[model samples]
Target: MSPRLLLLCLLLMLPVAALASVALGAASLPFGEVWRDVVSHVTGGGRPAQITGIDDAIIWGSRVPRTLLAMVAGAGLAVAGAVLQTVVRNPLADPYVLGVTSGASLAAVAVLTLGPAGLLGPLHLGVPAAAFVGACATLALVVVLSRHQGTTAPVRLVLAGVALSYLLQGATSYLQLRARPDQLSGVLFWLLGSVAGAQWSDLGLPATLVVGCTAWLLLHGRSLNALAMGEETAAFLGVRVHALRLQLLAVSALLTAAVISVAGGISFVGLVVPHSVRLLIGSDHRALLPTTALAGALFLLLADLAARTVAAPMELPLGILTAVAGAPFFLWLLRRDRSAAGREV
Candidate 1:
């Protein structure tokens, strides 16, 4: 399909997905009633009639926030992936390549095991806050280390991230090893990730960070496209390579950080969504940004929907579903690449 048509189709799917998100969950909600409730709530009519207490709670509390989190997290990740790929000029670069997820995981685990904030409280304090701090600190370290006497070092930056990831992973593993059984369960679940515990109160912070960063990214799409060719080439085209580089990297990191704060660690939305959009809409970042946002949001909402409904009352960990769904698809891409390369060879 043409990009125009594809955009419209994806846009249409957004509302449909949003509606489906409301309609289906662990509760046996009648679609009609769910829709009526949602429409009433959204249109200012008030809560729809409910047959039971649980249904009222499920429709109002759980599903709305979970679906919104999925949408925002998915969009944030997809944008982060696109930015990382452009900034690093590596097709394989995704938001998590920097080991942001590792840092977040470590922080979360620490919160779970031993902290001033006990169990439930620290889960809020120690996890998300520590994750964002880790992301910022790692990037600062990478930026400082990636520079030599005076020059920007792309390979150095990437290598530094890889090394840092392993180091952080080691720290995270040690925490897990020493935790009490209850703490271990907390740590394990955080590592797995889910939107099961979402609340409307949870949306504002991550949404602001992502939406702001996305707007910034969209504004710089042209520069990003030029930069994709190479820093020197982008410079030749009158792009301020360093300024733009720092800006895009900051935006990507922030986006990754925000989503990781809520969802824990969702891998490959960044990788998968961008690649999928690029195939359909081509590589113009302007088109790709919005397209990726819509597609990514829709993709994740559907994934979350499946995560909720597929297993029914027992919720599936979203991380497991995304990885299970994404990893194979990614491998297929790799296999295709090998086949093409083999033919060429």
Candidate 2:
């Protein structure tokens, strides 16, 4: 199928997925009622007379924000994954794989455990801010470690990321052990990833970053294509390879941090969505980026719906579902790459 057609199809599926996400939770409201409530609220017509305060609260307060957060976080993470694959020149690169998510999680967990009077309180850094700082620091460290006489090797990048990820995750585990009993559940839930506690206020920064950074990325699609070819090739093509790498890394880290700050540690949306989209629509960044974003939004919307509804009252963590789906795909990719290498040799 053509990229444009696939894009349109994804665009159409978004509302359907979103409506399902909002309507099919534990209570299972009727689709018509959900639609009416949505339209009423969006049109500024106040709550529908037929809709009770409880129903209105469920539709507008909890599910709506949660769905929107899932969409925003999914789009941001997918785009970040696509960018990282190009940046590291590896198919295996993603926020979770590269330790970016762990870095962010460690920072956010520290804040959650430490509370108002803790170390970061003096700096006045919230969870999101601390997570962003941690992501940037981790990405910088990985890049530095991956450098071999000034250029990054794909294997070295992956190795460095794996090492740092393990170390940071170990730190995160230690912090969890130190958390207060009441705080531990919240911390565990956050680490596992969920949009269950989403609110209107949580939507703003992630939405803005996803939109703005995506636009910025779209403008540089040709540069991304060049970089994907290789640093030597990209420089030969008149792309400023080093400067572009730094910019891409910074943007990707920003995107991951923004999403992780709010959505916790949802994994594999990045790895799964972009790669799937690339397989379907080819790798023209202009098309690939937008389509990946839409697909990511749709993928997470459905995943969130299943996370809440599949087990009914006992909601599953968003990360568990994603990891379950992504891990097997990761192994397949490794095997496929190895087979291809063998064929070439």
**Top candidate by lDDT:** 2
Which residue pairs clash within candidate 2?
A: none
Question: Whole-model lDDT, candidate 2?
Answer: 0.87
Write model 1 residue lDDT over 1-345, tens digit each, in one string. Answer: 578998999988898898889887766778877777667778986665553557757887788888899999999999899888888887777866777677777777777686736434534565677777667766776777778887655677678778888888899899889998877766776787777788888788889988888888889889989998788999999999988887777788888888887787877799988877776667889998988888889888888888878878777877788888877876676565564324421
Query: What range of 10 consecutive residues in model 1 has the weakest lDDT sum?
Result: 336-345
Off by over 4 Å in 1: 49-53, 116-124, 331-345
lDDT of each: 0.79, 0.87
**Total clashing pairs for each candidate:** 0, 0
After TM-score superposition, the amount by which residue 133's alpha carbon in candidate 1 deviates from its true location, in angstroms, is 1.8
